[model samples]
Target: MTGPLHEQSVLVVGRAGGIAHAVAVAARDAGARVIAAGRHRQRLADLYAGEPDIAAEAVDLTDEGSITALASRLGSLDHVVSTASARARGRLGDLAGDAVRLSFDTKVIGPLLLAKHLSPRMRQDGSFTLFSGVAASKITVGTLAVAITNGAAEVLARSLALELAPLRVNAVSPGVIDTGAWDALGDQAKAQYFADIGARNPARRIGTPHDVANTVLFAMTSTFLTGATLPVDGGEPLT
Candidate 1:
C-alpha cells in the first residue's frame, strides 16, 4: 500500500459495472481504499464481493437526502469520482421530460450535491473527478439530452474547482467506450457502430473502461490539475 494514492480513501459513485467498477479496481490496485457506491447497495456489494479494498455503499443520486446520508457515513475522504449518468437518448420529439430531468439529476446535480456535502469532509489536497462525455463536444442528433447534461457537468467541475480551492475538481469525458452502454444496438449493429466510430476517430478504436479509469486516477493524484475536462475520447470531436 505504498503507491501514489497509498492509504488514501477514494469514493467512486456509480453502477456496479462499466467505468465505475474499473475506477474502483484501479484505485484499490493503486493502494487506496475504495468505496463503490450506487443506487443498489446490495447489488454493488455483490458485484464487489471478496474485494477487501472496495466496499459497497448506497446512494441515490437523484435524492439530496441520500447524498447527505452518504457523506455522513464517510466522515472523511481523500478523493471522489462520480461516473453516474442516466442518458436521455432520442430526437427532440422523441425525448421525454422525465428522462431529461433524470439525466440532469443524476449526472449534473448529483455531483454538485456531492461536492456540497463531501467538500467539508474531504481533505483540502483531495480531489473530485466527475464524468463528462464526448457527446458534449461531438454534438450529433439523438444525443442532445446527453450532450447538454455533459456540458453542464463540465461547467460544474470548473465552478466547483474555483469555489473549492486546493480541493481539485475535474472531469473525465470519454468517447464511445466498449461498454454495456452500447449493447442496446444489438451485436451486429453495435459492432458496425463501433467500427464506424473507430474508423473515423483519431484513435481509430473504441475506448475501454480501463482507459477511463487511468484518467480518473491521474485526476486524483495530479495536484496541479483542476477545473479541466480531460477528454478520453480518441479525438472523436475533431472529426
Candidate 2:
C-alpha cells in the first residue's frame, strides 16, 4: 500500500474470504486507504493487523441501521465494493423462504443501501463495484439461490449506474475462482475438479482470486466505465 489509487479511500464490504480478501490486498497495495468491512469486528481487526492504512469497520447487510452507523464513521470514500453475499445452495424445495430472501438482502439490497447512504460522501470520480458470479449465466441445479441472487446483482449495478450518475457503478462476474468456495468438496476433489474445469476453459485455467481482484481494481479506477458487468471468468462462459 502504490498506483493511481494512491492516497484514495476505498471501502470493501465482506472482507472475510476469497475474492473480497484479495481485493482488499490489491487496493491496499495500490496505496488506497482500505477499509475492510464485515459483520465480524474482531475478525477484520485480526485479519488486517499486518497491513498499513487499512481499517476495519463492522456492518451487517441485512440491517439498514448498521449500515447507516458505519457510514457516519467513514470520512470520505473514493471507491466502494460490496462482495457481500449469502446463499442457500440446494434444490428449490429444500430451501426455506427465509433463506432465499436473505440471499437477496445481502446480494441486492445491501449494495443499494450502501449507495443510498454513501453516495453523498463519495468523491466526484468515485465508484461503486459489486461482486457477482457466473451462475447468472450458467444455470445449474441445487444452486437456485446463488443463480438468482447473482443475476439480480448485475441488474442492480446497472440500474444504480443510471440513478447514481457521475459516480460509476459496475460489477465483476467471476467464474470458478479458486477461492475456497468449494473447500467442502475436499482438497483432492477440489483440485481435480478445478483441473477438469480448467481444461475446458478458454483461458486454459480456472480463475484465481487475483484475477477477480485485479478486475475489481480496474472497475474502481476506470472513470469512463459504468453500468457494465465484466466477466473475469477466464472465458469459462465460452465453454
Candidate 3:
C-alpha cells in the first residue's frame, strides 16, 4: 500500500461521494492517513466506516469557526484537498443572489479560511489542493456564477501560494465529470449531456472521479508544482 504519500496524513474536505471521496480513497491507497471532513460528519463517518486508514470528521467551510475547530482537532496534517462547491447554475436572469453568494462562500472563502487555519499546522512541504472547474475557462452562458467563482478560486490559490510561502497551494479544475453532480438532469438527460460533452471535448469522453483524484495526489506529492491550476477536464476547454 505504500506510495508517494506513505505514512503522511491527508485531509480531504467534501461530501461522502464524487470527486472528494475519490481523492480520499486515492490518498488512503497511497498509504496516507485520510480524514474525510464535511458539513455532515455522521454521513461521512458512515461512508468510511470500514476503512481503518480513513476517519470522518465535520467542518462547515462557510463557517470559519468550524474550520478552526477541525484544525485544532487534527493538530497537524501533511496535505489537504478541498472539493466542496455549491453551484449556482442558470442564466443571469434566472440566477438568485443567495445562490450566487452561497457559491462563493462555499468554494472560494471557505478554502481561504481552511488555508488560514490549516496552513500553520501543515508541514513546510505540505500543500493545499483546491477544486476549480472548466466553467472558469470555457465561459458558457448558463454558468456565469460558476465561472466567476471558479476564476476567483484560481486567483485565491495563486495568492495563497505566494502568501503561504514554503507551504504550496494549487488547484484542480475538472471538466464534465460523470459524477452525481449531473444526476439532477435525470438518467436519460444526463446520458445525453455526457454524450454531447464527450463528442465535443478533445478527449471524447466524460471524466471520471479518478481522473481528478490522480491529479490531486500528484499535487500533494509534487513539491515543485505550486500556484497552478491543473485541469482534469479531458481537454474540454480546447474544443
Candidate 4:
C-alpha cells in the first residue's frame, strides 16, 4: 500500500496478448515481480525472455485441473490479472456451437475458475483484475457472443468483489484498442470500423494498449477501489 508495487508479486493470466504484455511490463517496471501465464509456451517465454523479475508459465485456463494446478504452484499471490478471451466475430445464425463455447470458456469460465482457485492464495490486501470489453456496454451486430461474455464477466467481478472482501476485485473494459488482434479484419473493414468508432468517441481516436494498461495498473494499486468496472474506452462510453 505504500511503495510502488515493489517487492510485490503479480500473476497475470493471458500475458501473451498485447494489452496483457503491456500491463506485465508496466507492473514490472514499477518494481513488481510478475508471473505471466498463457497457452503459448514460446510466446510466454519470448515475452519475458530476458526479464529477471518476470516468470512465464504456460497454462490452459479452459481446463479446471490446469487452473487449479497453476494456482497451487503460486503458493502466495499479491495480485491477479486476467486478459483471457476466445473472441469470435460472426453473425448469430452463422456462429458455431464450438465458437460460442470457446468464447464463454475463456472470457467467462476461465476468469471465474481462476478467481475461485486463486482466492485462497491471495493476500488479504491483494487484488484481482479481470478483462472485459466495450462490447459489453456497446451494441455491435456480429459481436453478440463477445458482448454477452464480457457482460457476464463484469457481473461476476462485482459479485466476487463482495464475497472476497478485503481482496479487491474489478474489471477493466477496453475500447477498440490498436492491438494486433484487429489484423484479422481486412484493411478496408478495419479502416471503416475505426473511423466509425473514433467519430463517435469523445476522445476522437481509437485506444492504445497503454490506455488499457494504465487503467489496469491503477486498479491494482488503488487499495480502496473495489467492484469497479472502469472503461478505458477513449470516452467512447459517452456515445
lDDT of every model, 2 decimals: 0.95, 0.90, 0.94, 0.88
Predicted candidate 4 versus true structure: per-residue lDDT over 146-197, tens digit per residue: 8988999999899999998889999999999998887878898998999999
What clash pairs does model 1 have?
Answer: none
Instruction: Arrange candidates by lDDT, descending.
Output: 1, 3, 2, 4
Model 2 CA lDDT for position 52? 85
Q: Report the C-alpha lDDT of model 3 over 1-239, residue by residue, as the tens digit.
A: 68999989999999999998999999999999999999999999999988879999999999999999998999689998999999999999999999999999999999999999999899999999999999999998999999999999999999999999899999999999877888988999999999999999989999999999999998999989999999999899899
lDDT of 2 by residue, 112-141 (tens): 999999999999799999978898888889
lDDT of 1: 0.95
Clashing pairs in 2: 2-30, 2-31
Q: Pairs clashing in candidate 4? A: none
Candidate 3 local lDDT, residue 238 = 93
TM-score of model 4 vs. true structure: 0.94
Off by over 4 Å in 1: none
Better by lDDT, candidate 3 or 2: 3
